[model samples]
Target: MRTSRPWMTQAATRTTAVHIHHQTNDTTWRSYMTIRRAWPCLVFGAACLCPLPIQAQSYPERSIRMIVAFATGASHILAIALSEKLRESLGQGVVPDFRPGAGGNLASALAAKAPTDGYTLLLTSPTIAISPSLFKNLGYDTFRDFTPISLLATVPNVLVVHPSVPAKSLKELIALAKAHPHKLNFGSGGVGSGSQLGSELFKALAKIDIVHVPYKGASIALTAMLGGEVDMVVSTVPATIPFINSGRMRGLAVLAPERVASLPKVPTTAEAGMPQVVVITWYGMFTRAGVKPEIVERLNTEIVKALRMPDIRASFAKVGLDTAPTTSAEFARFLREETDKWARVIRDADIRVN
Candidate 1:
């Protein structure tokens, strides 16, 4: 929104000053005209390039505080992972504050009241976007109270089964579940979690009946799978990738539009002949609204750079997270679209939380 940059103005002033002085000296004037004729206006790569603003130079004068919506869920893990890379890029420690409760409302409420100095931020999942639709009284307006910085990554929920299960693919799993009725058990992190919603969407699309088993967290749900307490678990790639890769758990399908690069052999639900079965669990970063536009752009630039690093990309890919960095404006648009989409799903499913 800011078109006039102070640095660009300063650069243009210097260019004018030099040209004015050259007008008085015949030799200098000839040199300036020759250079100008060769380079033209826009192509003039003179010392007239704009530098970064002074305010951006001093950003994060101290440690940046990142607030997480979940105490020990994927949001916290993602914040920790990105913090390491962010600290390396910004030269300041990016601290994570876990304020988990109220179905992610507590963190958003606190972040809304935090200073708009770019120090305090929120790292959240679809819960924040889904709050308005799921709850009767959401404390903070997601679109109004926050400035979306970047979409950190898109983590697909995989339909994973213990090796003992007979189903080898998503279609096979559906057929088997249909025949077995309520005999099959599907695990989730908890009620209303991405894992749960993804599993529910699968049931509605595939028309299979599998009892839902809610665990305290994703780690425990995964543990239940390893112990044979649950037949299948539709969890994030981060929690299921290692087990799936090691042959301990078989990946039936990914709940994304396309096959994941990390799990190349696994087909997407759409590729498995069920294009309606799509569930995306994502991670995103947001600063309090009303922060300076320049600082917001600077944060996006550095964060995007960090995500582009080879080591960072590998670490995220290893867990089945696709690096999806975007401009602040683009992220804002995405947030609105996701909020609208989840609203319809929650309303149609009659999802409710106390």
Candidate 2:
């Protein structure tokens, strides 16, 4: 050790302490910097390694439930055909589940509360619009409770009389009803049913006093007609076309703007001099409200495509249905118009159901 001046000795001691403190500070700072730089990368790596539950780009991952509020057969044959086609388009099993009752008001109420997902849908007729005015106090608001995905098509009703009724044509039926007054009875599926409205329209237009006999369903009404328990029926062409051809019933006039392809020889209500007697029972698809617009659009597109398929078109034609699909907005507009038109008819005719 070398001897030094007092100030130099003090300075050396202080410099050693400063150098140690500086080294400690530098080490701590380096450690902190290393941790800070590695933390973000570590977090990013972990995020990339973990699985996230993201929604699929496409929808309808599971089987879809279609609520059918009516019976099967020619009555629902076209709807069934369309459902099968929709299944193919959606890459999912679209099943029809029937729960028919209350003029389809029951199924409508159930569908209104179903999940907003596209999995649940309603395959029903235009009775949806009429029900609002038909029923005094229904559980759901027809227009607000559901979303109309697409208008499938309209099935024109035909005025048909039982062979025993003695009415050869629409003209003869009007004359007979006018002569017979309240004694000329007509049967319908039920009070406020599409058939009932069709009959009412005919009565209103022809200015006749015909009694309406309500049955449980269209089949029942047709059976009553065949058994001579009822005088006549204004039902769908498909429902009564075979009977008409078999001579059990006589096709008077079609309740369409034009004659149906299946019944070309038959005249339209318009051509029969009763243009206001038109009543078409339309069928379509509706989804639960709050469904995403994208899903609704997808469903509408698939339905329109399904309706246009040649086989589907032929199926509807065979059943005397006009197979056409309308957009959501268009369907909404049609529903409003139909509701208004029928409201006037119902009010004017004093139509009521028990």
Candidate 3:
């Protein structure tokens, strides 16, 4: 209770100050250690919230898969040719899976639902564009579910007739058809096929009533014509070239932009006096929807480059397919326009497949 000596008091005060300083130091150190221990958790929580960016350079690091929706036909030819070119360009092999059934619907559905990682691609013809409107319960949407890469090639459908048909030219045939509506029956591979579409388009544009006789395939259709079962047949140039050369079937017009080399003597549909009767079975590439725009652009660039190579062109030309290269945007627009165009034709013609 008594007052302490001044020196001792001063020393006690100093001791208290030293004790408080030590407590403060200990509290601060504890707080710092708590933060240090929790720093990893905070960082880990942040990382879990945000994913790191993937390097785009490592893209296409594996073999790409191409889905072709046809049998061993023009679509197959296009897929093989394009795959060969892509192998040369991408340093990776393109394995083609031909899922040919349901009017190529099976393949299109699978391709539409495939992963949008630039690995699984679809190489199909205008059938992709035509099927949407041609069939009512088609599972996949063409433009919505697909990312158009490029328009690969275009093959003309040569309109041919059995020698029994007296019509020598398209004008003669149209006049004959108009003279005898529904009397002139045209053969096609199947309903909603390229041949059928072409034949239907001709019927509508020429305002003729040509009945459609669908067969199992173009060859079969042409065979029917040879047997005199059908009056005329709309078939691929390659399929009907031999028949035309043998003088069994007569070529009236080529439904293409210009005269095909295989049938140079045959006038184009436009040249035949119907400018809107171009029926090209075009082949194009598409990927699954929701693909990154940059990835699509890259794919389009590579594919267009592949199509331009002379080797690719010559190989395709051998089969009467002209390698048609177009930008992604252009191809998309073309798809849309063709869809609308074919839809109109299908509706007007009342063409449908169950």
Candidate 4:
């Protein structure tokens, strides 16, 4: 065999000697040195993987800003109640920043571009689902720009008619509409408002053609109905309950799956033989996409907890809102369903907003 090189012989001898020493001596010091050599790598790996947990634990280190889609009305009330409750639970000021404009799009755009740090949140109604179909140039993608946290509450819309309309029930109204297609008309808050969509859904399912009269706001539309300016209207329970109770407006059916407690006598659309006409003004929480899952989970937990509180539930109910807390995944699926359903309704009805 060829003679071994000098460097190879030296390496073999050193390896043999180290092996012998390892076998004969205690390995505590050797192990310590090995760990010391790997300390930086171990720290780097941990730093990469452990940050989320650490951040989650220390989250809400400061006040949180809640962007309310509507400056006033049910949404604002819901935001104030939710913020006050969250402040109590999270020990941080959860401030409601009203950014109402452009049919709730201004607040949505602001929320979509907010940092994914869980500090800025959005409390909005179904406008998030309806805007993509109603407006052609929305600043944010409804599905892509936000992460749904939870559904806070819902207020069902009740279909009511002027006492002069002579429709005592949903069936009577449908028959009347079919009997006189263009003669019957319904009023709404605006062209793209929930009341309009609810009436459109009702029209599509019932196969009737009731002319639409859009007012500046739902309150105005209800007032018009009260004054017999419009034959029918789909309005929130709180706004129209007094009228219904006072016999100023005839409640045909509530556009929801179940009869509301406030209007226990009013049958739901489903009970009225049209299960597809359910339309409720829903409020939910959202954050910018890419927020850490841990933070989202924490927020959802606290929100659901706050919603279930007796005081919160009672407060919401006073305004005809029912506590409807849902998990994040469930809320996401619900949002998608709402978006698709409204999209179809808008397209079929040729609904558009300028």
Candidate 5:
């Protein structure tokens, strides 16, 4: 890591120059004598004050690019909302690039290759954690390729079905699947995506075999479910809430540990008797590995602050994302745990991208 900052040297030189001129002044000399008498305490205070210039100038000197590992629209609606808040708070432009393919492996690799100057970031979910085990040849390693920044939110997936489906509850759905194994199909954003994992976990816990139908994106997947192309879809509540309310889709159960505020009537997967299928989509921020620890801390603090804002909180709630922030270290540990947990699910369910 680079130990010296050019900006800090410039600021310190300016401070020292201004003080040198003041040394000749009578009033300044008297003040200097008083400070020198208390030099031990005064020096510590002075050094603390001197470092602000470097910190202010070094971070985000230019616009930042945040790569979203999903397509445009509902899949990334929450990310764009959070990015807008971050831009307002940091006073730097924030640009988002949505790269959708290979279950976000393409975007993750692109971010891993970018410079680790804090100018580039990745906005994504646990798929970054889950992909390494699912694909035989993923380009980048999640733990090795990036530094975990902060956790943005935990989005719960809802088990939604087309109104035409005979099953009205999770219990009934499982029974129906048991009666006709491999006949029911579940639509997902794509293979190895969070929706896929949610559905996979569901199948594992329920002891059922629902055919997986991977679509290009969430919209298409939801379209398939609504058109009866697929029997059910395990997706985020925000994307399916409108349809559920409109009677186009019915909520069989939520994959969250607890029922969501928006859908108080619906039961969680555990409440519906399958306690092992609890899965929620969690999004976290990341920068390429090798970014300074101080830079990571600064970004994390700002992001947490941005998420706490009333408008930002409301915007997140509007889209069914709970505004919860986790420290970088905490998020890193969580990522590892989630990766291990999902890896077991993928293996147990015999899930694979190809």
Candidate 6:
């Protein structure tokens, strides 16, 4: 309206072009930022869909700690052998850390509190199944806090008496106990040990009254029996094998379904007229609950493979143990049955521990 100058017209046109350029740049930058923010979400969704195999493949990044329930005896032997085999296959060190007390509860408690990661493993005996019934307070729930990996091995418990006892057979021992109710005494690893429970089950089944003398461990109890400090002991075949062979102790009967090769002369409880008196000391592997299924499967596979190896089997066999590997589901079912059976025995025998 004022003046139609060439310079003014040119200036207005240039201003319009600059405004358009700024608008275009702002729109492009917003689109880029939206994509950048969404990148992590897209990756997370993909991972959720296929996580198991990847997690398993990447697992066991470091050495694993195997908590041995007992420092000595068949459990320790099995642990060392199994750990060696696992180390070879898994390419990670499987170290045995002995925590022997409370009839295996100390190790169980420590294992139960460990992270749900696959790095911590527990190697235990039937005490795991027995503790729930024998103890008033436990730190972990057997079924809730643990995931069974596999049943590694089983050793037969033999009722062995010192050389001084006159009884030669299971029946003779029962009659002798009947003649003198509290004269004959039995030694055990501890109050709630498998040896004690096995002996209690025997007492309940045979209707005999024998005093129970608790020792720090089964080996100690066996030592006591050897020294004639205790009359008899329900001990593992391996611990009593040398003594029996050397005439230091007499094997009354083996508490198993079949007689062990190491003690072939020893009669099974079934064969000894007490079919209900079978007590097997078993070793199994477990990890804290909530571990990935893939990791569990991996461990189960490796254990099964290791147990099948001839050398491993031979090593265990030499010590009176049978390599009894089983799948996770099978072991879990077996554990449940063992727990129920021991619970009944504990309740009937009135066994209690603080």
Best candidate per TM-score, number? 4
Ranking by TM-score: 4, 3, 6, 2, 5, 1
lDDT of 1 by residue, 1-354 (tens): 110000000011111321211001233324433532453242223214754578977887889999998877557657888888789878999998999887678999899999899999898877888777776667788888999998787766778999999999988988999999999988877767667777776776566788989898777988999999999988776677789989999999876655666678888776788654556777788999999987887787777777767887777665556666666775776677667655655554556665
Could you tell me which residue pairs clash in candidate 5? none
Tens-place lDDT digits, model 2, residues 249-344:
889898765677677778876677765556777777898878887687678767877776788877666656666565676566656666766675
lDDT for model 6, on a 0 to 1 scale? 0.78
lDDT, candidate 6, 83-140, per-residue tens: 9899998889999999998768999999999999899999998889888887767798
TM-score of each: 0.74, 0.77, 0.81, 0.84, 0.76, 0.79
Model 4 lDDT tens row, 1-354: 110000000011112321211011123223433543464455446546665577777888999999999988889888988998899988999999999998899999999888889999999989999999877778899889999998888777889999999789999999988988899999999999999998887887788888999999999999888888999998888889899999999999987655677778888776788765667788899998999998997798778778878998787777777777766886787687678777777877888776
Q: Return model 6's CA RMSD, one decimal.
A: 27.3
Per-candidate local distance difference test: 0.72, 0.71, 0.74, 0.79, 0.73, 0.78
Better of 5 and 6 by TM-score: 6
Better of 2 and 4 by lDDT: 4
> Relative to the unseen true structure, what is the C-alpha lDDT of residue 350 in candidate 5, on a scale of 0 to 100?
71
What residue pairs clash in candidate 3, if any at all? none
Number of clashing pairs per prediction, in order: 0, 0, 0, 0, 0, 0
Model 5: per-residue Cα lDDT over 230-287, one tens digit each: 9898887778878988899999897755678877777877688765465667778899
Put the candidates in lDDT order, highest first.
Answer: 4, 6, 3, 5, 1, 2
Lowest lDDT sum, 10 consecutive residues, model 1, at 3-12
Q: What local lDDT score does residue 268 receive in model 4, on the 0 to 100 scale?
A: 75
